[model samples]
Target: MKSGEACLHRLVDKWLAPATVLSVRVVRSGRMPAQRARFVYIEAIAPSGSRGMFFFRHQDGCWRVFPPHDARPSLCVDALAA
Candidate 1:
């Protein structure tokens, strides 16, 4: 499994421990056309018979609970040589 996927699993295990994961789906967000999957949706059932959905986003080469911020254009200054 990829590092990002592994991170997602770890997150699920940490936050949703003792819960049974029902399904996991990966889909790309239209906002970030350059990258692969921008988000992952997971469906799980807890020991208490409660169902919940989780969303994970790909950011900084790993999976995170929050979405990545949009990249903005920036200007860079270069030094001049004689």
Candidate 2:
């Protein structure tokens, strides 16, 4: 997994512990939305990128952040683009 994916996984773990992350795969990155922050978008790959966005945020001085899962979704994913 790429560094982004690794970071994403960790965030997901912290936020979705019992929920289970299965895996994280960054497909694409986008420009930093004109916000000068510690993180910025590089590109948006597609399916994986779109899926990954759901669990991303800007937290603790970092972007692509994932908070703990407060609610469960209809689906759980263990792959890049499920």
Candidate 3:
């Protein structure tokens, strides 16, 4: 968790000074064992006073940043394009 926090700060450093984590929420989808997937949702406030969100998935016994599309297939790629 610490490492992930550090990484998030670095990632937002260009646009925002640093990020202060506001909340961390863990969620699991599906009731069936075979369909279950765990994810961590992070809400943060940037030094510039803007809010941001980050999503990570449990894989290989560790949480890692996952693609937004993988996290939610409903999101449009065009809207998220840089």
Please give, for residues 1-82, the per-residue lDDT of candidate 3 as tens digits: 5554535434434333343644333333322243254543444454445454443434444433553223444777898896
User: Candidate 3: what lDDT?
Assistant: 0.42
Ranking by TM-score: 1, 3, 2
Off by over 4 Å in 3: 1-35, 67-82
TM-score for all predictions? 0.54, 0.28, 0.34
Model 2 TM: 0.28
Q: Local error of candidate 2 at 64, Å?
A: 5.9
Global lDDT for candidate 2? Answer: 0.42
List ranges where model 1 is wrong by over 4 Å. Answer: 1-6, 19-37, 51-53, 57-59, 79-82
Q: Which one is best on TM-score?
A: 1
Checking candidate 3 for backbone clashes, the offending pairs are: none
Q: Tell me, what's the RMSD of every candidate?
A: 5.1, 17.4, 12.2
Cα lDDT for residue 80, candidate 2:
44
Better of 1 and 2 by TM-score: 1
Greater-lDDT candidate between 1 and 3: 1
